[model samples]
Target: MYRYTDFDTAFVAERNRQFRQQVRRRISGALTEDEFKPLRLMNGLYLQLHAYMLRVAIPYGTLNSAQMDQLALLAETWDKGYGHFTTRQNIQYNWPKLGDVPDMLDALAEVGLHAIQTSGNTIRNVTADHFAGGAADEIADPRPVAELLRQWSTDHPEFQFLPRKFKIAVTGSANDRAVIKAHDIGIQVVERDGQIGYRVLVGGGLGRTPMIGKELADFVPQADLLPYVEAVVSVWNLLGRRDNKYKARIKITVHEHGLDEIRALVESRFAETRAAFGGHDVALFEEIAAQFAPPAFRNAPTEVYDAAYATDPVFRAWADTNLSAHRIDGYAIAQISLKAHGETPGDASADQMRVMADIARRYGHDELRISHEQNVVLPHVHKSDLPAIHKILKANGLATANIGRISDIIACPGMDYCALATARSIPIAQEIATRFDELKIENDIGELKIKISGCINACGHHHVGHIGILGLDRAGVENYQITLGGDATETAALGERTGPGFSADDIVPAIERIVEAYLEHRSGREESFLETYRRLGMAPFKLALYGEETAKKARAA
Candidate 1:
């Protein structure tokens, strides 16, 4: 958790003050909705279908108890009783009145959080591995670099109004929990001959045109990272398509121009940018890095955890599914699931947020993290505290042991809150999760990532999911399409469509057929859905989904 310095605090205060005036002008009719659009977007406010949605950036997904409490307070005071955690690791309050937005921003500023750069066509929140600091296999924590990028891009005049919105994700682990390959800029912190550097990837994104980022630089030394990143963005800023918003992203730019040409342009630009840096950015990175020093870990026996694991099947199930290895002995990372069986995927009530905040402060080193999977992470919990933490989480409806399962879905706000959505997505996600829970075979099925988006925008990251669901309006009815075998990992690949779309009524059954097909065709129970899909390919699943007659048609097409 990086504490805000006096400068940081002052900077946020000034921004909030400015936004407050902007908000008043809009409310007072000094500015119309069209005039207020960009101003509101710059401040992370969106005029949704029903009401204004305020998206607050949880930079690098890091938070302390106080910040979490402030989020809960915002949910309780201004909007509905719950807040939606997004795939970007940001939080959205979907029911705020236009006039109360400034007060909400002030409340967020008090906790060192803000809504800046969340909605605009700018570098969005710089996300990182939720388990950054204490992951078992991390080379280094990626949050420091994420924070550095946040400071670099927040209001960078040169890069703010790019051709389209840009996103950057970082990961220090070899396992790719941050989905770096699916970002506009993916940074992997790697060590080369004991010298820390970055492996930079560019042009990776998920939308109408999904792409896995290409390797822009194999090893950029720590000192050269900022300039190199800037050069890449600068090159794309000038080269990208501006006439059509659909093709404006850097991914399309890379596709239009070969990676080699992009690399050459970036390198050429890098030379000038690197010289301009003159070691200042490196110095600043070092100062920023110090703020992210790991919390002092305490050594203790895990007798309580051992006892609970042996005695309570309930606790054991949660521990097995929700817990991950921590770097330190006797410590573990606990993932709190917001996707309860029949509930919304990422909506957390204010009380539940408070409970998590309390648990983090009590037994998790006073630090909490929001994962891009729409879950919360207790990144530094001692094993000895697992039982008590699980007990607390269970009482608050946060103890769902379905992490990485079929029910642990990633879904966008869709038609329920997003005006851009063509059809509803939340109901589809809820139905799928509920149906699978009814089946009681999720544990048997193994790791599955089902992502759903209401449209082609891919906000839910459906392009990277094992079972990707896209909801669209077909003629006048809601239709859902499916893509199989897509991955968002070190070996990232986009899923392929499984033929004709299904009606909303048939979507769940189609998914069930796909799962059944996976179960029957897999080499063994251990063979996951993704592995089975890879081995058997789309032929069998399409046959299962569309049946023999339609399968022939799909294959022919």
Candidate 2:
């Protein structure tokens, strides 16, 4: 993890000091809620449905054991005893009081974490692959680049107040675990000939105008990344619409103005930005590269793990599903599913956080990572220790083993928490997960991503889910819309709307119907839900999900 430099430390301390005074003024009745809104948002404080929600940034989803412990302390002392981990890998406290936020911010700052840029229309947290350095398929780790972006965007005067919030995601792995396509700017680390570079994707986003980013540059050398990224943001900042909040995102700009036009503008801006840099900022890249050096790995036996798995069905199930491929031999990346059956999708209680911290310290080289899917990653856990770790996780309700399965859902804090949500999403996700667990079809169905967004903002990346569910408020009633054929991977494609939306009560059964339809229509047991959906199209699933009349109308073509 990148330690905050003295400059970084001083800057954060100053911000916290300023916020403390501002908070005092607000509480003393010198500033109204309207007057304090922007300041609170700048500091990542949100006045939510009930109380204020404070979102703290976990840069690039990376954290140390100490940082994890600090978060647990915050959850226990400041607000609720739990924190909701967001899809962006940040954590949110739903019950922080207005007056106590400065203290919370101070506490976060003490641990090299801050809420700055976690909210508002400014550049949000720069996310990357949770298993960046540890992933087997990565050409180069993307964490350094993400850190570089974080530094550049943090309190940058030029790009701070854009039309809307901007997000950037980087991934070095061949698998698109970061869901880069759903970000405003996505960077894929790739190798060209013998040198590593970035394949820059611009204008990709999910909100109202969902768009898959276009490849802006085929191979931007690592040295030129900062200048190039600045140019892209600058272009969007100047040209992106501000009058309409709906059209403020880069995705809308890309859609309204052609990709070719956006590329040309970015290139023109890049030329000017490059001249200004004169290769000075490139050294920061080197400094950042040094910060992200991989942990040393040791060879170990898999015999103990095998023996335990052979005996414990829980350990076997968790190991089979929760573990992912690690770059180092004899190591595995352990993804602890926050989306356990009937729980909030991405919430971890204080005790659970402590347990994870303990596990990371004991077995995972004293490091932890938060994945974009709202799961925790023990990025460097040895395969030999899988059984013991599984035992710990199982006792703590963290060993559900539904990673990428039907029940491993990514859901927003819908109406239950989010003031912007039209209908509830977490409960729907919970019901679906619980229903699937009851049916015992999760592992059998295999690798299905079911993302749910409360509204069309698509915060949950529902548009790209294998089985996308969008919740909406229809005439004082909650309704769910299902989309099929969506994918979030190297071969990314947006899922199409299946047919009419289902009632809130009808959604779980509808999802069950879709899964059953896939089971019947699939070519074989080897065929996954997404594969079958793509091969046969949405006709059969639509027929099963909706009634015959709607199915007939949908399949008419």
How high is the CA lDDT of each candidate model? 0.93, 0.90
The lDDT of model 2 is: 0.90
Predict model 1's lDDT versus the native: 0.93
Locate the minimum summed-lDDT window of 10 residues in model 2.
Answer: 202-211
Q: Can you tell me which runs of candidate 1 are displaced by over 4 Å?
A: 553-557
What local lDDT score does residue 418 receive in model 1, on the 0 to 100 scale?
92
Estimate, for each residue in 1-557, the C-alpha lDDT of model 2 and write its tens digit: 79999999999999999999999999999999999999999999999899899999999999999899999999999987999999898999999988899999989988899999999999999999998899999899899999999998999999889999999999997788888877889999989889888989887877666778788888999888889999999999998899999988998888888889999998999999999989887888898899888887898788897788798887888888888888887889999989879999999999999999999999999899998889999999998888888888889999888898988899999999888999899999999999989998788898889999998888898999999999998899999999888887778888899878999988999999888888888888889988898888877887787668877887787
Candidate 2 structure, TM-score to reference? 0.98
lDDT of 1 at 522: 93
Per-prediction TM-score to the true structure, in the order listed: 0.99, 0.98
